[model samples]
Target: MTSAVLHSLGAARPYAGSRPLVLERIPVPAPRAGELLVKIERASLCHSDLSVVDGSRVRPLPMALGHEASGTVAAVGPGVPDVKDGDRVVMVFVPGCGDCRACDAGRPALCHRGAAANGSGDLLHGEAVLRTVDGERINHHLGVSAFSDYAVVARESAVVVDNDVPFDIAAMFGCAALTGIGAVLNSAKVSGGESVIVFGLGAVGLMAVMGAAQVAGTTVIAIDPLPEKQALAARCGARAAGAPADAEALVAEHAGDGVDVAIEAVGSARVMESCLGLLTRGGALVSVGLPHPDQVLSVQALQFAGMGKRLLGSYMGDANPARDIPAYLQMWRDGRLPVELLHTDTRPLAEINEGLDALADGRVVRRLFTLAP
Candidate 1:
């Protein structure tokens, strides 16, 4: 099997010149115990992947470069008897070890074991299944390197989906849909008749708009620098959408003093700081963005007590893939959530670097990478 492996980091863009990701035919080991060998059908380019390309978020180098994807289970490893070969599954970046303290508390996204493995670029069980032709080990990205033709993932990382769903649509449930929608439905817990604003109208941010709309009577506002993105946000579900310059005014108009909940999806410390200012006195700010580790966010210590506001960090939308993926699929089926509105374009696996350029340029919301079987 071949995979797009990142041998070096911090390549300057146009990416056409730097070419950080190298496509090479690598060897794939068979599924280990409690794992699955997935034949990836669709993968999506996310800002998280770009963070790695640009060296904003550091990780082990010479690693396979994708995580958000959907595929069919080619084979299921021993001890994962609940799943079977031929099952259609969406691969989650974090593979929860069911016995971990976080998993036991129903917060699988915070599973300590999973975090340790992902940080080391190994699968949940601490194994690297990919290697270069010269035998150099290629680290897995968050356990699901869906950029390759095939991926070996922990059984806990995959949530089975119905075969009827389109591969591209099913793929969305893995990351963008899961994190964005889950952030609204689970983390912030926005209710009907409340006002909500989302910062950064990228795939995750736009999905946040759609999630807020799903709640009846919610006044939704979207903020982005791009006018086209603002327009798309209106179509997605935002009652009002505009650039950052007009954000405070828009919030005052649509949400009165402030919004009940504000979601920061841009991963910008600056934008996150702005989200805090736009919230209502008792409102909460749910930050789902993955900023660089070294970047720091400053907030007045008195604000939490003075204004009764809460700042919460959300990872993977605090999603339990097993529970949320199916529910989200049903929401898509019922027509309440038009997730299809998020898809901007599609590219082949070979065009991944180019896709990253598009994502960074703000030319797309969600770009799918269709892979050959």
Candidate 2:
């Protein structure tokens, strides 16, 4: 199996020149207990993956990079009772053990064991299934590591999906669609007739726009510095889309007293503060983007009480893969959620470095890598 492995971090821009990610043919291990061996069909580049490449999110060296993906179950290990061979599955980055406090409370994103494994670049069971020709270990990225042709993932990380779903569309369900839509429907619970302002118009942010648009009478406002992305957001159901400088004017024109829900997907404390300012009294601000470790948000202490405002941190959109992925796919099938629009194009796995360059340059929304056999 050939996998995209990140050997070093903080590589110079134009990743094509730096060549931070290397393609290596490695051995695929058999799935162990509570694990499944997946034949990856499609994998997509995400800002999170770029973060690791650019040294923003540090991880162990020689790590296989990929999370958002869809694959077919080639084989299942012992204790994996539900999933079977030939089943199509969407890979979830956070693999909930189903026994943790957070999982018991229906919050898989907050699973302590999953977080620890991700931080350590191991799978849910604290194991790395990848190895080089010389036998050096390669860390798994968020338990999935779907950048390769095949991957061994914890059973908790694979959610069975209908086989008919296109692998490309199903791949997005693993991350962007799940997080973005979940933010609107589950985290913020934006209802009909409400107004929503989304900061940043990446795949996740744009999906937020799409989700908000699905509700009756909801007004969606999308903000992005890139004109192309803003245009894409408009097409994704944002009633109005523009640059950050024009956000206030758009809000004033479309939403009289600010929006009911303000979603921050830019991962910037500055942008999060701005989101808070765009919310109506008693409105909620959902922070879906992950900020840097040192970044801190400053706000007036009295606003929560005086204006009845609420600030929330949403990880993976508070999604439960077993429940939400199928529902999102169904919405896609019904034409209510046009997730296909999020795809910019597709490329081969060998061109991953070039793809990262496009992603870093904001040239595309979501570029997928076809890995099917």
| Number of the predicted model whose lDDT against the real structure is largest | 2
Task: Put down candidate 2 lDDT per residue, 248-296, tens digits, no spaces.
Answer: 9999999997889999999899998888888889999999987877899
Error of 2 at 15 (Å): 0.5
Q: Model 1, range 1-373, lDDT digits (tens) per residue?
A: 7688898888998997778888888877789999999999989999989998899888998889999999999998888988998999999988899898999999999999999999899988757878877878899999999899899999988999999999889988899988999899889999999999999988898888999999999999999999999999998889999889999999989989999999999887888888889888989999999888887889776769999999988899999999999998998999977778888877888888888888889998889987673
Kindly report which residue stretches of model 1 are placed more than 4 angstroms away from their true locations once superposed. none
lDDT assessment of candidate 2: 0.91
Clashing pairs in 1: none
The regions of model 2 sitting more than 4 angstroms off are none
TM-score of each: 0.98, 0.97
